[model samples]
Target chain A: MNGPSIQKPEIEFTDNIRDRNRYGRLWVYIFRFSTIIGIIALATLLFNIINQSSGYVVYEAKGDPAALTLDGVPIEEQTKDQLMRVLSSHLSKGAYSKLDRTKPFAERSRNDVYDLVVERIVKYEVVDSWLLWDSLTRKDEITAAVEEEYPEALLRFDVWINSDFLRRPQSSNPVIAGVRTAVLGSLWTIGITILFAFPLGVMAAIYLTEYAGDSWANRIIQTNINNLAGVPSIIYGILGLAIFVRALEPLTSGTLFGVTDPTSANGRTILSAGLTLGLLVLPLIIINAQEAIRAVPNSLRHAGYGLGATKWQTVWSHVLPNAIPGILTGTILAISRAIGETAPLVVIGASTVIYFDPEGPFSKFTTLPIQIYQWTSRPQDEFRFLAAAAILVLLALLLTLNAVAVLLRNRYSRRY
Target chain B: MEQIALGYPKSRNGLKRRFRVGENAILALLFISGVFSIFTTIGIVYELGKEALLFFRTPNVDLWSFLSGTQWQPHIDKFGILPLFTSTLITSLFAMLIAAPLGMGAAIYLSEYASEKVRGFLKPILEILAGIPTIVYGYFALTFMTPLLRTIFGRDVVEIYNTASAGLVMGILILPMIASMAEDALSAVPNALREAAYGLGGTKLEVALKVVVPAAISGIAAAFIVGISRAIGETMIVAVAAGAGPNFTFNPFKGAETMTGHIVRISGGDLSYDSIDYNSIFAIGLMLFFVTLTLNLISQQVVRRFREVYE
Candidate 1:
């Protein structure tokens, strides 16, 4: 009796799981399918863009000119000031000149039309053909561009490899068919959008994340922000039109434009376009930034408090720096989305007809998506090709920006 | 509890008191921002709300009519949003169907079958694919996927703008959502459970399906809902790949316009402020926002309930 002990019962249920296939085979199939799908998707995207972009016929030489020679000949014989005037297009009198030929593509690409009086166009060994597209389509406009710059060599105009329709700006002449103005417009617009939105977005995020105690108010704000992020962006367009365009026209400009006359943009300048876009992106920026800020530990905040620091000091000294990487990632994403935005800008009266680069924040501008849409909608086949090329460039810029953001976030992630 | 003196000092130090006072002002500063955000939110709501109310005041503003009607011609007379709403939900649901299985499959492979090394490589790659801009994916779906889809099933299978292609690409985007979330939930299951299953002579697949998955059911469900929200809010890919005309149809093969797509199309057409036409955007925006918010809230609550967090 002393030796006897209570015994635990033996487990009796049998699994009897007679699986047919090796587990690895099933998993291998799944993983392989996933990778294949992803790769194909990415490859198809890049390949289509490259194929379309490469098919574009680069003109021997082309661009906007300030004056027309009326005789269609090369401008190599023209003087420096005349070429400068031609390059400036009567907008401003900036000096320009002949860049050295036989340089690398990067250097050659840098040479403006003003610098290319004798300078070579991009990546072509053609010594004599002036950089220009044929006036086959544009009898009048072609004559004007040829008369302006190629007064000497206009007769020898053949499509060269230096200036594909992708590299130039919109003009009455197909010779000026490129995305330069659009690309710059996108840059400036997105730049302004970032500058306006970043501070406010980060501040709001900081307030929400590092400061707000868990409460009904905080929860409500968080919910509202997330919902705002989901709100169709066109609504923001309506908002921008009402609040920024019509209602605040006086603040934008007294006469709509600084000029004595009023235009469609009237007071609707690059600033207004950027501000509208800024508002559109602000909710996303705040949400992502809040997530980043929240990732920083409460222990870090407590440590600072334990050290007799104030909440502001603790956040500044510890929280923000820790969250910087995430904040940057979110900012970059917001910017990427802003760069691709077209709808809101169109509604806010972005000038679809602009030919010149925006002169200032007050000046009107057009961006990549807008320009692409204009080209895509047109009946011209060449314009479609040009649109494809422009898309490639836009994609590259967006990708590079996002990649850098991700890289930075990843690199810094290790430290924390 | 024993560190009673750790509490903030009741009296200020003379030398540091000014700094201390400034420091104390931080709470107020933060509180002020909270107040400011509140006001800003109110301002937006007021602006949008006023426009929506104004729209309702106009003749023949019936909520039921808007919900059930098919046409979306705001300028002429009939402004039915049902077609667009239907398209949005259908595309999102279609994407969920394709993505859920593939995503769950990948998750199972990741959590149960793959070694740590494979996981590291695959996870980052998948994320990178997911990280690529939706704009790029939009282009891909249109150019690449459409052609392939057409090849498999005639030209009728793919339209220049159709739900089928977009749903496919959106499925790819949601892949990461399901994978990461499912992995998180599945990985949360205890090792002891797996060992117990093995001791009972269960196969790996059996153990995964019967024990691990059931344990993580709530999380997996939440992941799928979050994926739905992601799909609903998805804009660029739809704008690019899916056609602009908002058709009221359930067929995935046909060109259907989503709510976001309609917004894009309208915004592109240059409507001036508060045009009875323009107020339609605000109403739609409110609808989209509410749907997504509810989905997100459900997702969050589900995660909280499912999260084990055992020490």
Candidate 2:
């Protein structure tokens, strides 16, 4: 096979090997660095949110608190009766009546009245705010800047994610704004979404795995599901708008059921958002459930048949039980995605500012992500801080859901 | 025979009929559920097509002009889609620029170099990155990435709502997706090829790059296409950070509205049902749907071909 044997360049070969090894090690570092970049991005995102959630705020009241004193008694020390008198005198008749109608002053506690006085009468306006990092690192600069800019303003380090932030409803004032309504809306929407999507998805998966033969209809259905999974989420919003919001308004707005709310007389209700999200996640759930069902051993089915169990009985008793954990894991992940979705809800007209909590599927709604988007869009820095705080809550909820899903998959998943 | 022996023939016949009915009913229900997914696709096409047809039928919205014109001021009766299309292209391409190399590198590391324990730890981290909400990524784009860019390139050079920040953050948002998909593809490449490369004195990097990666090129390409499709369809980040109004520009430093961003902006406002603005969003949405659907189908086809090659 060899016409001539050439002398081997041993030294050159050794040199080439050294160079290649050096380049190889360098590439390994580069690849590792590439992997670390994602971690860094995640860390930075969390850090940014945390940095903004707690911050130093410089604020001033339009009306002096000292002016509300009766016989040298401070507003905080004053009785509820005194606070009510101060509020009535300062606020217009219409405003005071509206406040009274909302929650009668008679039912209000002393502290509540005091808070109202401070909130409504004093009208604390945020002049400036600095993130946690700046407040901690550049404290003297911020102090000097605030002192020079706003002499009468009070400075305080405020933690924006307190219990009050979770309990209170939305407010135009960033200091008092909370995610109570948004959280409730999100809960109601997600609950309905799961109710609609879970059974339908599992059933579809069962039919595909257990019943469907190799027919053109089944193939098209399978392909359609895959394509639907990749469709832009906003397109689903369009479908929701045209179908659920308009075509099925009688149902989505609960008009057919005779449970219509004048505020949400139209179909931009939690039910519509929920149904849209259910559709959005349907393919995901189906695909996952199919995989889970396929993982069930064929022997199990044969064994069930040997015991004279019907096909339906075999699927319901044996296949479903074993596939439950995998199905649950997939559903949880899908639901988490639905939870974070904002565009579809926005397209379906999720109210940017709604103070009342959503009571049912027919109620007008806002979600935590929607709140964050709305708040972040505001020109005010304080709203940005509020948005950051809300992001913390959203992240916490998602992380917990993911952790549960992971645990379920790791703990219960069978190799088979 | 057994029923007749037990003297319950009529009852046994009735029970069998009921069981048969129940089984048929269950099958019908399951079949309907399976068919429901098809209805979703039909609904999307019907709704999008119906509204988009009306959008095109409007006297001012010439289909040719809408497809060709550069200006996109809907308020001024301008219905040009080029501005939005170009912006989408610019941002998507920029995202791929950052995502492709980094994602491929990460995929290689995970598939070829990392130990089992390392993979176990890294994979979940990547999943976490993938699972983080796009809205959160949008927030990071607006608050962090924009500021970082401003500091690096000067405030005057980098607009607050430029595509650069949005695109960069979008790259981060999709990196995990590309990485995971590409890793799956790379891992699918048989190890015999790797050993054969090593027998010829191939280094780990050479084997991974020259041998394994080439073998899995189709799968990796499919992953890239999917990543690009995802970038194009992504809404929240662009809506939040990629400017409000559409501008026909290729400059990443200057803010421009994407198709998804335009839809979000217009729909977020209160518009009458029959208004042009309301219908225009659907038109944009239809285009987005078709584009993403085509890309996804292509990627799926590529994946199928790759599977045939190995399996």
Candidate 3:
């Protein structure tokens, strides 16, 4: 190592250097802290959601479910037919007839009938709930509290996100509530969204990147897409309501196709919501697909042209195969977004309390986010737990979809 | 043999003519697909503008009073835009307060300090944060942040459904947007400037802050602007956590309605078509569209400016 130089700079070099070192070190910490805050925020979100989703609760049944059992079998162990019979036997004749009229008892799932029985006839009500930590740390206090406050209530440790929660339909009574209808609706909406957006988006991307010259029309199209991507989703809802719902009511309601239900002729159907969401995600898919298309090397195109192939032939054969995985990745991401979207759907008039599964595009629907929003808005504490559970389901679905897209993208990336 | 060669040329010419026709048709179809975005924009403007004009022309709307007034009680028929605008502003400002520093700091860390491996790993995690739906963020704000804030500031001081809770969650929601965009801007700066700073015996932090950040200021500004636009447009979180009623007070502790929240509230409720209350939502939506659209356009311009300078 060389010795220190005898000639020093005129400025206070050592002091300035020390000061700079301190400032730099402080800034490093600051930046690190900033990134850590993001990580912490994510952790907190997951933790908070999980924390709300499970706990111990003291529940009181409105009536004894055992009273409906004819064979002295436990209510939980009853067969599906037995459960249906038990459900009808316990309800008042008027109530039973009304329920039958809503949907034929035979047509509904065994699980659905059972949940209805539990909700309407048996009436499982959460008298009180304790957080997981409180239930664990202060068991005696909770026990005493339940004993004193609700002498007839049974206390049980409940996992809010159980399979039953997935199987049953939404209820005013949170104990028997599930996300079955919402899940089906979300799937239907996203199905239609992909159907409408994917092909159009890909075509737009291909035209913009491959076919179009540097013309004013192409530039305007690009500008419109960029601006559309930033438009608030609620605006799309207004468009859907005006154009799809009101202007094209016959088409959206399936009336033009002669599948008319008089009650649903108003055009507030899954079709409208799906189209609105399709518009919401269209810009995103186009942008991503363009990127994917642009990433295909010019050499591949040159080679195709050198073989005397037509432009369309080159694009169809050489360009598309390479870009398919990327395009799919973008489409999947857009689907994830469409599934989670609430604002545009809400604006398009998605039902907040639809009990039946959406049978077709013309059927009224409610998505998971809408369900969660509705549940959270309710004053009941049990519904809050149910909302938390629904949130978990939504997150899981989103993450899984995202993971699949990422995996496919990585697989394709390795080949290139 | 000459007749055979002439036949071949004739067939080839016919095939070429057919191909040209088919190709032009296909290009037209693709061009139509590209033009859909312009159609969407026109549709949005027409739909919003048509309803908004009707709302203004409705009896007793008094456009002047509606613009300048402070109270917003639609049920009682006092339709002031100020309360909604103010709440939107307050929440977005507070969100910016949280997002600006943290997002910038995270950007600096990812671009200047973290190794390539770390950045690759962390970047997706940040994207996960961005991917979490605003509705989930709403749930988080309502169930978690409000209670936490209550404990810190005391129960009476912070309402259960207040702007602070929604604002904070909204900040967290937009944090990734800011950080990712800022990082893109920072990394886009040429390495030569950074290398020159290091050669002058500058520390890593100094080189980043003094050299890189300034070089990327336009981009960082764009990121912040976009973040603000997102905050202003965000609906679910504010709708769920922010108070249902429109309060005229400036206190973030008290619940007030934002423009998006107002739109959602009206839409969720069973309001009749063409009712004053219903039309008012359209008007509020028009204002929201204006604000976000302007901010977005400005951000785009700023980013374009940066691209010209750096790229």
DockQ of each: 0.32, 0.50, 0.47
Tell me each candidate's TM-score: 0.76, 0.94, 0.94
Which of candidates 2 and 3 is the stronger one according to DockQ?
Answer: 2
lDDT of 1 at A414: 40
Tell me, by DockQ, which candidate is best: 2
The candidate with the higher TM-score, 1 or 2, is: 2
RMSD to truth, every model: 9.2, 4.6, 4.7
CAPRI-style class, candidate 3: acceptable
Per-residue CA lDDT of candidate 3, range B1-311, in tens?
13112111245535753336665677778878988888999888888888888889987678887888888876677788888888888889888888999999999999999999989888888999999988999999998999999999999999988998999989998988999999999998999999999999888887898899999988999999999999999999999999888888789988998888888888875556677776677787788888899999999898787653744
- List model 1 lDDT by residue over A1-416, tens digit each: 79889776698755433333476357568755764565565566566655544322323333323234413544645555455444444333222222222232234333344344323222122222211222344445655664665454334443321354446556534434667788788888888898888887888887777656577777788777765665555657656766777678866543544454224456567777888898888888888888888888888888998998866788888889889898999889888888887767766777777766666676777888877666655545455455566677777787798789879887987443
Give model 1's TM-score for chain A to 2 decimal places. 0.69
- Candidate 3 lDDT, tens digit per residue, A15-96? 5777878888888999989998999999998988887788899889888866877688877878888887887777788998
Roughly what TM-score does model 3 have, to 2 decimal places?
0.94
State the C-alpha lDDT per candidate. Answer: 0.69, 0.90, 0.86
lDDT of 2 by residue, A143-172 (tens): 899899999999999999999899878888
